[model samples]
Target: MFAEIKNIKSEKSDLRKFGITIGVILLVIAGFLFWKEKESFQIILAIGITLFIAGIVKPNILKP
Candidate 1:
């Protein structure tokens, strides 16, 4: 029981880490896009692609 509880906690931690990493990456991308004068649609597209790649690389991190 304790092991299961530990596993659950660790999974939540991993998810948090993944979220933070993605958030930072997106912020940087947004900054760069703004600097380059890109359209809002382009920024949204970049975010979608980033998330798609992240999901492929870490499917487990996104599990519910």
Candidate 2:
């Protein structure tokens, strides 16, 4: 049981890292889109913001 709990903690830590990485990537893409002045910039920005928020709220949501 102790080992299982340890494994779960590690998994959650990994998921948090993964979530942050994904969020950063999305934000970067949004930044690029804004720099390029693309019509889809707002859409991507919104998605990026949502993902970033989701990453914070529940890192495991993006896990799979």
lDDT of each: 0.62, 0.73
| Residue-wise C-alpha lDDT for candidate 2, range 1-64, written one tens digit per residue | 8767655543666777766677778888888988988878787777777777776778777655
lDDT of 1 by residue, 25-64 (tens): 7767777777888877466557755655555466455644
Tell how far residue 13 is off in model 2, in angstroms: 1.0
TM-score attained by model 2: 0.65
- Top lDDT model: 2
Which pairs clash in the backbone of model 2?
none
What's the lDDT for residue 38 in model 1? 80
Q: Which stretches in model 1 have alpha-carbon errors above 4 Å?
A: 1-10, 41-61
Q: Any residue pairs clashing in model 1, and if so which?
A: none
